[model samples]
Target: VERMESISRVNSSDHVAACQRSNVIISLIDEKLKYRDSRAKDFSAKCQGLKFLPFVTKPAGFSLNWKGNYFKMATMFSAAELYTVEHQDVVCLLKPILNENSPSFKGCGSISLAVKDFLGLIRKPTINLVLNQLKEVANYCEDITLYQENITNACYKFLLEAMTQNEANKVMITAELKDCSFILVENTYVDAAKVAFHLNFEAAPYIYPLPNKYKNNFRELFESVGVKRTFAVEDFAKVLESIRQDSESKQLTENNFQLCRRIISEGIWG
Candidate 1:
C-alpha cells in the first residue's frame, strides 16, 4: 500500500505539473486573435488540385529552418519508408546515448527513453499510435530548385487525403504509388497554425507559429518533445548551468575550464 501510494503521488503530481506547463504555453496566445491568412483560400484551392496518392496523410510536426531558405517538414508518413532511417541523422544523435560506458548517459533516462521511443520506430513499427514517427530522410533542396509551390502542393495533397479519405481508400492509394513521390522535396513551412481555420477539414496542427506573433515559441516546442529529450537536454542544460555558476563565483581558473571541457567533451564526444 505504501508503494502504491507513492506511485499515485508521483503520477498525480506529474499530471499537475504537465498541465501547468501547457497552460503557460497556451496563455501566450490571445483568445481574440485568430490567424488570418489572406492567401489561405487561394492556397487551399491549389492544395486541393494536387495529384495526391490515395491515402498519404497531411504533414504534422512541421519544423522551420529559415536559413536553408526552404522550410523542411518531416513527411511523417506510413511505413512506406523502410530502408531509409539508417541513413538519416539519428546515427549522430543516438550513437552517443547508446554508448555503454558514457558517464553522462550510460544508465540515464534519456538514453533509455530515446532507445524506447526512437529505436523501435526503425525496428518493429506501428501506425496506430498518436504522433507515430516514421522517417526524417527528406530530399533537401540546397537551392530553390523545386519551387515553393510544389512542396506546398504535396502538403495540401496530404491534407486532403488525411481529411477526406476513408481507411479503405487510403489503403488503395498505397497500391497505386509508383515510387516514394516525396523524392522531390523534404518539407515546406506552410504555417499549419496560421491556416488552421482555412483547412478543408477540422484539422489539429502539430507545430506552426501564429502570424504576427512577437516571439518564436521555441520553449513551447521543447515542451512538445520533452519526454524524448528530457534526459538528453537536461544534461546539456546542466553543463551550461555549471558554467554560469562557476563564472558567477569568480572562479575562472584553469581547473574550471578543464571541468567545462570534460563536461562538453564527455557529454557529446564520448
Candidate 2:
C-alpha cells in the first residue's frame, strides 16, 4: 500500500514536470512561427519574384570547419562572447559542495537528480524515442545556413530580374544553367562558450606524439578518408609494408585489418 502511494506521488510529479516542459516548448514554437511569418512577409514584400531554392535532403561531403570568413547579424552583445548558460557563477560556488573528495562534504554524493534521471532514461533502449523528441524541438529552431541562403538567393533573383539578355547570358549562362550546380560550402566560427565546451567536456584526455617516421603516413591515412576521397584496406597495407622489414602481407587477414584500423584510430585520438 505504501509503495503504491509513493509511486503515485512520483508519477504525479513527473506528469507536472512533463506538462511544464511541453508548455515551454509550445511557447517557443509559437514565438518562432510568429517571427518566421514576419520575416517571410518582409522578404516577400521586398523580393516579389524571389523563389526559394530547395536544398538537397541528403547532402554529401558535409564537414564543419571553424577557419572561415562568414557574415554575422548584429546584436548588442558580441556573438563570439555570448554565454549560453545563465548564472555560471552559481555553479562555481557549488563546486566545492558537489566535489566528492572535498572535506566539506558530509552527505551521500551522487550525480544531480536531473542527470541521474536522464542517464536512467538513456540507459534503456530508448534511442528512437529520444531522437523523435529531439526532432520535434529541432523543427521549431531556424537553421542559420538556410536563413543566409534565402537572403543570397533573393539577391540573385533580383539581379537576374534586372539583368539584360547578354548580361544574364554572361553571368548565368541560361542555356548551360542545367549543368551548373553549387557545391554547398558551410562556413563556421567557434565561439568562446563552444570552445570551452570542446576543451573541458569533449576533448581527448591525453594525446601522445606520433613517431617521426609514422607521422607523415598517419596524416596521409587520415586525409585519405576526407571529402571526395576514399580509403581502402590496401592504403593501410602500404603503411604496414613501409613499417615492416620484410614488407609482406602473409598475416594480413580480416581480423588484422580491423586491428590495424583500431590502432590507427587510437593513435589519431591520442
TM-score of each: 0.17, 0.15
In the predicted model 2, the residue pairs found to clash are 207-270
CA-lDDT, candidates in order = 0.28, 0.26
Task: Compare the candidates by TM-score and give the number of the best one.
Answer: 1
Candidate 1 error regions (>4 Å):
1-9, 15-108, 111-123, 126-176, 186-270
Instruction: Give the C-alpha miss distance for residue 146 in model 1, angstroms.
Output: 15
lDDT of 1 by residue, 1-270 (tens): 122123224334453332232223222221211354344344333322221101111123323222112211211111222212232222211111111112222111112322222222234222211011111112333343332333333332342344244655444333322122222222322211122111121111222222222112222221221212212434444555756675897767675566556545654343
Clashes of each: 1, 1
Q: 34-103 in candidate 2: lDDT tens per residue?
A: 5655553343222212111111111132121211112111101111111111211111111111111111
